[model samples]
Target: MRKRYAAQNLLFISAAVVLFAITSCKKDRTTTNNNTPVTATPTKLGLYEEAQTDNDTVYREVFITVTQIGTLTVPDSLSDQVFDTGSGGMVIDAHYILPANMITSTGFNFTGDSTVVDGITITNQKHIIQYGDDNNSTATVSGNLCYASVTIGVTNGNIVVKRLPFYMYYKSVDNNGKALPPHEFDVFGANSGYDVTFPNNAFITSPFSYFDPGTGLTKGFKMAALGTANFSDQNEVPLTPDVITLGLTADDLSSASGFSMSQLTESPPYGYQPYIPATITYNGTIVNDASILFDTGTNADNYLEDPSLNSRNAVVLPTNAAVSVSTTSGFKYAYTVGKLDNLTYVENPQYSGVPVSIFSLNFFFDNEYMLDFTDHKLGVKSN
Candidate 1:
């Protein structure tokens, strides 16, 4: 399940576990040239989207495309099925997906299915339904499934592997080390194509937004390095995610060729996303319990923006106070949230009572945001 937001941008998908009912699929159809997995290689993908704020300020989304225009060949049963051509759902952490509505081309919509190839099995898979806004949107899908042969070319795509052979988003395991099968949202991520993928250990963004046509800069790298790396440019600060083990799929049961998602990753494919500590201080009231996701996706700066606990509520700064955020990685940012001139709440209650703060695409301002998946740490280097 996947969704993207405007004011409260969220790149991470929440985990869900349930049973799905399988429906039969028929007819083969050709998928559009969409997210195709690349062979592992050091490929330079250009930056993605750019957004504008109320004050007319602009911010660029930081994701680098991992796929190229490629064909998606579907089975005969799904041939007449319509695939999403515009505004399909985004990948969870890194997979492409669609809701029942997006694929209604020939009046065929999303339904649970059981797919088996040469005794390899991934069954009871269903499409995701999105609810709420970015600050707190939720996805619902069932699991006990792996390896969907979607047109995206099973298990091969760049950053947002919008296809099958689903890899990420498994959240359960059995005593014998078999995956309980949570949900398969991603079938892409540095699997076969090593060339375009970042070199292991580390890679750093060029400390500039993708759309920032710098006045005097011309190195042409919005992002860089990795060994001690899941990187290309070379490194200093280490970035890694804190493993939470939301779900697990035994390596043996995961592939027909005995392929395990861990083969391409420094950690088990089940590791939770990495999060770092952030100390948020507003009006001298410091909240040391805050945590921040050092993600390459868009950020809402702080909850002080349009994304508060709920969509129906106005998320203004506390008393319009000045705010300061200090990360454990050693960067401090100061800003102030002003009263709103426009107020329109959506009655969305996804994050109704939870607190949130994010490092926006522009938050890493004048420094390098380093990610070290192997070590589970995030590093920041002053530019």
Candidate 2:
């Protein structure tokens, strides 16, 4: 996902707080395998009478000030302060309060200093936080507290406090028809784990690898290129024309053979139209194409949007109950349960459901992939 900003309707702390609650809470925490606690449950505190009274006083004073000053205004005097003034004097600030009884299922910890986490580096000034892909899906944020503080180097850079946003894009790979582990991404940085390389060309981004379920041969795929163009904060960006392409190759096409390199196409026949291809599967007997787009982020197991096709029988799934399938990447996707309509043998009928199963990112796991901007293709390879 990429971030977009509005010049006039700039994001502020208050707006960010509201947007955070809406977008973050909308995600069903049950889908993530990571142990990070998503939300905290409230509990009654057995505080002493004196402590309660003190808390009440503090709350009243803060509330009154907030109401009077308005949440959007920043004190001019405070804005002039420098980074060395200490953590409390930054341009923006946000507070995260965990529920009293909250317990993390998977331990959450930071491994980097304040200068960077994931891949974004925050300066001492205020920055606008935006979220989403080319589609209209997005969230905006402003203020100082958008990120967490991580300690940097010593001397003038000893303790660096950064603003950490809650959302980021995650990338993964699927070989043949299996899903692989996902790789964490920074969304806006160069070293975001995406690598593009060719055996005869200089290595760039990482590549994801896997064995084709159809042929039982090891293969690799990676990103060929990526870029952003023609989008605005007020408009919804469609997923075609300006799109991402992937490059793929395998050692061999036969289950009993060794290996080889070949070009693979994954996009739907619509040529990167509004419909997003989400999943592909080969059940030893049949292969199905399940494509769909959902609001969930990288944690989504199967984010596909398309119909299904039977590889063995060369048939398509019935159009009754949309078949929900899972990939090796642990992503779950649903294919349209309807049969192909208006069968035409013409070269290109604008849109045709040849029952050809198309696969998306939901198929790879623990493998590195690349988006080649120069060639307009995606590449994948295994570690």
Candidate 3:
């Protein structure tokens, strides 16, 4: 009798211990983790963080900062130094763009038990912050409903991420469609395994007033082909005409099939830019397989063409003569250069190897640029 009684008590104690362990785990999972606070720093931009939901579903969140034209009260974290001012005398700094390579969920690690994740979309936004368009510009940043580890890479040694307040124009809400607070970047402190180091300081000067002293022009602004400055997004219509209708490239496209090499190039996009094939023809001179830097960062219409050309003055591309850019999927982007004769013939870009041409900010007015990663295709849409 004594032996039987002892065995019963032992069984009860073991059961109790198991129950306690299970309960403790439940508490750990349900409650907000103190060690993993939502307010952590050093966020990994492309990784998604788990955000709360109303039901059994768990949703992920990511933060995106766009360059918008308006009264942007620079966050103290980013206002480290005075960048520049807008045409309206607003404090200006270069705009922050999500790393083109890091913004997708191509290699995201899923933690849940289920293999399928319920993806949600939030629409009817009053604006698209990218182009500062309030209406008509229907832009969708698509991917695997990327799980934003809610990580913001605010600092990395000497490279500090100074950004204007993140404007989530198209996706300012959570996967569950919850509106996110402005500048609500989620980074998991130092433990986040990712460290972002940019080749250049994106926020050095105001995107609106970013003056490339090398070329010598000003205005992080809406400029006419003749070179005028205007920065007013009031009433959803800024002076900078929303020229190109941008689209997020599909997820399955990549460079493996000789489509686009952007994903395989470098850690950053600006450093690598978009690599494409082109033929620049001027004054009856045609150079095929030409090297060109199709940069959207440049704001002026007059760009830096290869200085090797004979005509020092701006070469007038005869009417009906368009610079043809060969793109992935057999798409061709043509920039009809008949409009203006303001190109400044300068020394070829110091970029190693070949002489190159640049398609700057003004180029957007004439053509649509597409940088698709997962889909592995880069295309140019001629307007």
Candidate 4:
């Protein structure tokens, strides 16, 4: 099942969860391309420096890509075969093909002349549909595409083929609740090098509304709809009705490998709540509840930002251990507490060289944690 976190209503009150705060500190010297050490003043503030009203202004965007593999043959008599992006690749439409058709049954017995070839297996199916205003205007499929192979028939003879085109709409929104113009693109296949393919004579209807670039709102369409048609009957027959519901898939955060949260025995004695047990080593010392953020967006090496604990360029350690970050976005950089750790100062310039302690997301290195927005709790576990 898919879990939804209502973060807007929940107030994050972890004093340890330091918001962006600025302080003055000394600058660090870095080596140039020729390995010559160059001293430069640090002015950029880290994310957890202090809490700012405009923090919420930053919005995160998620992109899901779906691809269709193998070949499907549909007779000219039957209507379009409806497929849905159910939760985690689960198919919701009645016309959905199941594994039984390929694994057990001889072929798929849908309306018209639709049939699965001998070697093909229906490994998975999903409907990439979404809800909300943009969704109301345009239709699309979200999530990764299904995968399968042609195990039986020849690539050419006795088979009808048509490449299905996948389409999606994109809308960029600012912090304010304002609509942005819509963008459209076809969801192409990942490795097959082709866009999409389905049976010949199959009807394709995409749920996408044309966006007015000037106003960033829907031009004319309302909510996009999905339905199957029986082309042979002359009358357009709808397969299933479209409704707003949360699609559940077997793939979820809990199912991800190497993710766990546990209680720690050794914890800080004062001003810290030990909700989850985790260990981060800095200069060979372990720190707990070090105000770690599991950001799927950070793209830098290790950096410290506490202005009150360490020298401007002084090393910032977890107080003890090693580190890891989430790989959802991209595993390009793994921020860690190196030997000469120090917090950077932002805000005032006079307090340079002052030792300060800052919070960072690099503390959760190689650990799996859960953010329970329902109960407003964060659980951490390490493997």
Top TM-score model:
1
Arrange candidates by TM-score, descending: 1, 3, 4, 2
**Leading candidate by lDDT:** 1
Candidate 4 — what's its lDDT? 0.23
Q: Is candidate 1 or 3 superior in TM-score?
A: 1
Query: After superposition, which runs of candidate 1 have C-alpha atoms over 4 Å from their true positions?
Result: 1-43, 49-59, 66-113, 116-123, 127-270, 299-301, 304-314, 318-321, 336-356
The positional error of residue 333 in candidate 4, measured at the CA in angstroms, is 15
Query: Which lDDT value does model 4 have at 73?
Result: 36
1-383, model 3: which lDDT tens digit per residue? 00000111111000000000000000112225564423111111121111333344222221122222222333534332211111011111222323233222222233332122222111111111111111122122111111111112223211122222111221333434454443332211110001111122211111211111111111111211212223222332222222211122222132332333333133132222234555665545565665455443323332434545554344444455545555333545455553333233332323211244555444444444443322222344444
Poorest lDDT segment (10 consecutive residues) of candidate 2: 59-68
lDDT of 2 by residue, 154-242 (tens): 22212122322322112222223232232212221211121211122211111111112112112222321121122222222222121
* Candidate number with the higher TM-score (1 or 2): 1
Q: How high a TM-score does candidate 4 get?
A: 0.22
Off by over 4 Å in 3: 1-264, 267-272, 302-322, 327-329, 336-355, 373-377
TM-score of each: 0.42, 0.21, 0.33, 0.22
Looking at candidate 1, the ten consecutive residues that score lowest on lDDT are: 190-199
Worst 10 residues of 4 by lDDT: 42-51
